[model samples]
Target chain A: MEQELISKKELLELTKISYGQLYRWKRKNLIPEEWFIRKSTYTGQETFFPKERILDRIEKIKNMKGDVSLDELANMLSPNLTELVRKREDLIKLNIISKSTLEFYTEERGKDKELNFEKILYLSILDNLFDSGKINFDEGKLILTFLDEYYPKFKGKNCELLFLRKLGISSCCLVSKPNEINFENSMKVVEKLNISDLIEELKIKLV
Target chain B: MEKNMMNLEIKGSGSSEGGKYNTVVIKGNGKIDGNLDCNYLEVQGHCEVNGNVKSESVKVNGNNSIKGDLEADEIEIHGEVNVDGNLSVEKIHTHGMISVNGNCNAESFTMEGAFKIRGLLNAGELELKLHGPSEAREIGGEKIMVKRNGRVKFTRIRKLIMPFGFDTGLTTDIIEGDEIYLEYTNAKVVRGNDIELGSGCNIKLIEYQNEFKQHEEAEVVTYKKIRKT
Candidate 1:
């Protein structure tokens, strides 16, 4: 099903963001240029945006405005990740990935080739989760496998990684949007995070 | 100019239920605290109104600030206007500036000055000679043409005391229509059935269905021909 959309007028009213501020953000690249969708109406052409995406983005920009500059936000938002490679020890020195996770990954993959940038970034996310005790090493393996298998399907779209744990068994799925998961049978949704968010956080730490 | 007309002159702070008046003129620093309904309105000095304004003809020679919407048959601005709401007019000819906090819907919109619009600018026919840097978040109409003003002329001395100078150009997020021609515009995306881009334009993408032409000096990142859906 297609998601509902809201007009520019309605979005301004709902967000209480002034026109100058909206335009300023657009110029700042905090909001992507393509989100402005035009449709002919009874009066004339009107601009609309996907309600969910815009609402989420607006909330994020508002929350992170004073924390970082608009240019920094734009850099974090852009999906272009440069293929800058770092070794296992360097990643550990940068505090991105831990020794334990690298050992586990080396144990999984044959320890003969240089790891690409994507695997390093994924390892960084799993390291955060593993260090914080959000998900176990098995769940981390599942996440890495999911990235290796399913991430290409998302290709330039906002996506989230969902993990559900029940009775010591944890599973993960990738979704375009987050949702409430109530299995109603003693199951709990362990963690839900955007893959891009992980990349953004990692980029920040690396920078 | 019309000394013979019965004018509602606001010399100081004033309020009106906004009845049908011949002309409402604000000569000095004036403020209207209520709705204004008049045939003609002229602001020669700084003015602030707290309510909606409906007029047949409005001329601004100074600064005008309104907190509500504006509806007029014809509006001629040689000064600045700041509206907090929408502007629905048949014709608007501005030689100064107009900043609208809401949408602007006009039949024939012509400007030789600058403007900053927070919302859409929808018109039947929109033509502008950009005096400086102007901006509209979104613009939609049947035919829209904008050209940068590069004529060398002696500006008025009164403008030296005003707050704004000539507009540099225009920056828009999106501009879409049936026929669109823009010069000295920097836009993210422009979609029209018939489109022409003149010089000094830096656009990211342009999707046209019918006819498309661009000047040699203009730069466009992407151009596509799409079938009408």
Candidate 2:
């Protein structure tokens, strides 16, 4: 999908953030380097950003500025999943994972000793899919096992989790970000989740 | 792992393997064959590292080259240093010259001679006393000050030896900062809150929010004051 683009000049005007704050955020790694798209204009070289994403990010940063330090903010927004461990009891207490789902996850993957960030994320994804009453228990287990085996390979990289159904038979696929795939008419896309966004969401929820 | 937990000292023409060390001192021609992780790295002569250099503090008084990225808390350069990849440091103080083929990120950067960065130079507080031709693709900082130091005492001998005269200016495509004071800088666009175009600056377009000052010798094609909002 084509995203709306906004120039750096217009963004600063709309956001009311000075150049200093913008660069400072960039230096602090709160703003990812890939977002600063350099394009040549009639006048000269100009910087542009994905309109919706950047605006939302700036809004979130502004809201969380006074409460947390920029370094903490950077960690929260960073694409790389930081090393975090959450107990299964805490996950249940926080209502992040349904009890049934947690029970199923532990049954398939042995006992839950200490759920790391990646494990929790995978559980949450499975729970989200299962809670919607779309996928069955078998498919959920498939996802859990698939993620457990393959997710580490994509660490610190942007990836997508795709759920597709062909004539009521569901299968999942994982691909790196900025990818385009065409499905046949018989295939239906059940759900597509950007792993990076999920990571950000899980990070915020954990915080 | 415990076999090489020691300091490395190369006095004359020698080569050593790179690894974790408490301190690495090279006084003469030395070569490091692998990645180096050290607490303190002091080079007084010519040295080449084939891999990345990670140190808490790096002091270079002579020529040194690194084929990979450099990460250090503090980097002090008194002679010349060259990096084939990116440079990330907390503080950088240079009285001679340094060049990087990739982006440079620093918290505080102070320079007296010159620098050439193939990519963006991003710093929190950037101060440059230009003594020779310096260039970067783009520059972004909080407070940036660029001034020309006449005569170029440190580089005078090199200048006299060369038949052609060098331009004592900073050339960048774009410069963005909070408060910028520039001299002898040629940039296509300059955007900041309070900008001062010192003598011998050639800017194509300038966008400022609060205040904009231009010297008589500076040539600015166009300028506009941004809205307060």
> What's the TM-score of every candidate structure?
0.50, 0.92
Q: Report model 1's TM-score to 2 decimal places.
A: 0.50
Please write out the lDDT profile of model 2 over residues B109-218, one tens digit for every residue.
99999999999999999999998899999999999999998564756686678647457899999999999999999999999999999988999999999999999999
Residue A86's lDDT within candidate 2 is 90
True contacts kept of 2: 0.61
What's the residue-level lDDT of A86 in candidate 1? 63
Least accurate 10 contiguous residues by lDDT in model 1 chain A: A18-27
Residues A10-56 of candidate 2 have per-residue lDDT tens digits of 99999999887898898888888878999999868899999998999
Which residue segments of model 1 deviate by more than 4 Å? A1-207, B1-7, B11-20, B150-167
True contacts kept of each: 0.00, 0.61
Listing candidates in order, what is each one's chain A TM-score? Answer: 0.64, 0.90
Maximum-TM-score candidate: 2
